[model samples]
Target chain A: MTTLSAGKRLKSAVCSTEIMVIAAPDGDVEITCGGSPMGDGATNGGAVDPGHAEGTAIGKRYVNADGSLEVLCVKAGEGSLAADGDALAVKDAKKLPKTD
Target chain B: MLLEMAADAFGDRVAFVDPVADSSITYAELLAAARTAAQAVHDSGAERLAMLDVSNLAIPVGLFAAGWADVPYVPLNYRLTEAEIDALLERITPAYLVTDLTHMTAFGDRQGVALTSRGDFLGMARGGGGDEDYRSMDPEAVGVLLFTSGTTGAPKAAVLRHKHLVSYIFNSVEFGAADEHDAALVCVPPYHVAGIGAVLSSVYSGRRVVQLANFSPEAWIEIARTEKITTAFVVPTMLARIVHALEGQESAHMPHLQSLSYGGGKMPLAVIERAMQLFSDTDFTNAYGLTETSSTITVLGPDEHRAAAGSEDEAVRRRLQSAGVPLPGIEIEVRNDEGKALPTGERGEIYVRGDQVSGEYEGRGSTVGADGWFPTRDAGYLDEEGYLFLEGRADDVIVRGGENMSPGEIEDVLLEHGAVEDAAVVGVPSVEWGEAVVSAVVLKATATQTELQDWVKQHLRSSRVPERIEFWQELPYNETGKLLRRVVKERLDSA
Candidate 1:
């Protein structure tokens, strides 16, 4: 189980995927990619599961239900993301306003 | 962390370009330069990295270097007098100053200060190699130290922490959101918060930034057309000047120019309306914030702009004059002098609280309350629907015969006159009324002082009319479009 914290970057142990924690949950949660537990950027490789091959895209935010967890993908990968045995949905964001 | 993410995601993409110099840098190159410069700053043992020049490549390099070196990046105003700059330089001693060739001799010998010209700084930056451990650094470390413009008093260095800046980005902007073809034109001076915000926001959004060393309406229009700029940010006066440059034209004629955002000062309704007609195909955003709030805390988006312009309801149409609602993570409240939250439509001090609000100064302690709200010192009220209408700085409020009056209120009335182009209302000394209303206006068509006074009298309280009126060709403004009220008072007081 990874202790979720805001701004912490995590890497998939199974594929070429990277994400940073934008909003953390109240407690430690086991997050997985391609049915393999993810690790920090430096980690040992693990085999991918065929059932969880929906893939991920860069620059998209993924969030689970209840609105407590949010992660932003920094790199694309051919592995889907899951937290606590549930799938994370890609958030449909509003067109951002230019704030500069 | 922001640059690291961008470099890792799209390292080969062009990031910053200088049109005049005909040069550009990629995201990876900027990352490398920042790391290399950070190492130099670490080796010199400087407590801070300060930049004192017009906007250039040194800005991005100096900014990230300071962030990576764990020192606050202080951007100095190139427009300041030598004595004024020295007074500020004295405060940030044990600092590394990155300046152009002209300023090398004046500040090179200062105690506990290391200096480099822009030329040498770029050279060292280009020879890039260093390790960055920003992920391990403290989130609360100071990231930027911006001195308040201090039109009211001596400049105070506002402290912005890493968390505050990062929070602002995460709250308002999504990473890598700009399309590949998007190019942004940045022309504001380095000292202004909008300058810094424009860089950081554009970088994180994966937009190519085109820099203009100086601003002229002709230069701005030429670059925007040539570069196919999709997005840009400007202060009110800059927008006004651009509108004037295209005075006889119906459209800006650059189809690729998609978005334009303006802030830093009150935008005259006439100017914005004219700008809308000129850039009919473009989206207009009005962002409102202060140096202490990282940049924009509120935005009136393009859709809202169109709605306000098209609405049949007088109340809905009045939103053109509003500053819009607060950002996602920000909370705003209008409060009276007793620190009590006022109801809607009651003009008072605006207090803001959020992770991005850095209310502290270098020497002076924080003005943030125990509950985390930072008093903006700006007088404004929220409409029933939560649109904020600014009434100018609270300090600028006029006291006429023991009654409080807002100058913005009276100025708005005068501006509604058909012939008046610009106006400034000031409270001058008057023994009878304690403070008398005085005005100086710029007119496009000829209008007499009596005619203007009657125009104001018809719209506002009789006591609100200016006791004396002075007509001038133009009013004094700083580089960022902020009215030099003190200068106006001095000029009119003497006249």
Candidate 2:
């Protein structure tokens, strides 16, 4: 179990999925990938569970039901992202007005 | 962290393009280049990484590389005279200087200076090799050091920390929000605050950027057309020239141009109105901020522009001249001379407070007050409806015979005249009055000095009317569109 924070990049220990935290609620929140705890960018491969084999996609944001935890998928992979065994849902992207 | 976010989120998407070189780099490629450049900067024994070139592919690489190498990125104004550039370069010794060939030879012989041409820098960036990881940088580390245009006094380096810039992006821009096809055309010089802001925000949003080294209305319009540019940012003068260039034509002819944002200088109402009519389909946003504020503390968004233009109500329509509302997490207050906040509609100095507001200079440290408010030194007020209206810089206020008046008020009246294309009002030394209001005007058609003087008198009181009127083919402006009031005053005073 690893603490979550904004801008923290977490890589899957089992699959090729990579996620960056966009928002996290106060206190530590355990983030997992394919039923295994996520690791930092340097973490290598580990065993993958078949139960959570759904994949992640690039440029998509996943958020929990409470909306307190949010992570953006930076790389696509076969491993699904979860927080304490709860699967995250693809957040509906909001179209922001263009301003430079 | 910002560029890394972009690279990881959308690695394959194009991050920047150099049309002159006919080359482009993906976000992944940009990240790799930054890493390599970081290694060179680390190995060069340079304390600060300075870029002294025009907008090019090497710019972004150098910027991110400096951040990755944990060095402050100083983008010097290349338009300055040789002596001025020499002075600034001397100040930042032991600097890794990435400049064009011309400047490299000019300043390369300095002690403890590591020089590389812009092309060779890009070549090195393409060849990826770096040991230091920039992702673990301290939030408080200085990210950029921008020297303010010394219109009033000696240029001071405004420092922007990583937290400030990151907070600005996180608060205002959404991560990975841009569509794959969306692109921004960046024409502002690297020295300008808008230029830096544009690059960072565009990268974080995952939008492609097309750089224009030199700006002309013809070139700008052509690039927007050929590149299918969806969004663009320009100073008021640029938009004015674009509008003048498009005169007598039915439309701008660029269908892909979706949004146009203008700032950096006060925009005349006449120019914006004409531009709105010319680019009828494009959304216009008026962004207002300072170099110390990281960028755009307030923005007059597209909806407000349309509403103000279309509305018949006098109050609603006047918003076209206002600077709009503050961004989220930014607090703006108009305060009187006594440092007391004035009620709405009472004009005073503009002060801003926010996480993104650094308000710190190189040697001066942070000028931010105990309350976290930074005096912008600009004169303006919020209307009853909370729309911020800027009334020129506080130092630019023209005091004539003890009656303090705003040049912006007088200039706005002058611009209302149908014959006047542009106007600048300055206070000149006067034997009779403490200082006399002098006007320098650029006219769209022939108009006599007496006629123009009469025009101001009819619109405002006699005291506000310019005592001396001079007609000029064009008024002096900095490349970024700021009116050179000091230059105007000097010229008129000497004459």
Q: Interface RMSD (Å), each candidate?
A: 1.9, 2.8
Query: For residues B306-365, could you state the per-residue lDDT of candidate 1 as single tens digits?
Result: 999889998998899899989999999999989999999999999999988999998888
> Candidate 2 at residue B62, lDDT?
92
Model 2, A1-100: lDDT tens digits are 6566676778888888888787898887888888788886545556667887888987678999999998878677888888988999998765445557
Candidate 2 deviant stretches above 4 angstroms:
A1-95, B101-104, B129-134, B446-454
Per-prediction DockQ comes to: 0.52, 0.32
Candidate 1: where are CA atoms >4 Å away? A1-4, A10-18, A27-56, A75-80, B130-137
Candidate 2 lDDT score at position B30: 93
Interface RMSD of 2: 2.8
Best by DockQ: 1
Query: What lDDT score goes with residue B388 in model 1?
Result: 91
- Model 1 scores a TM of 0.94
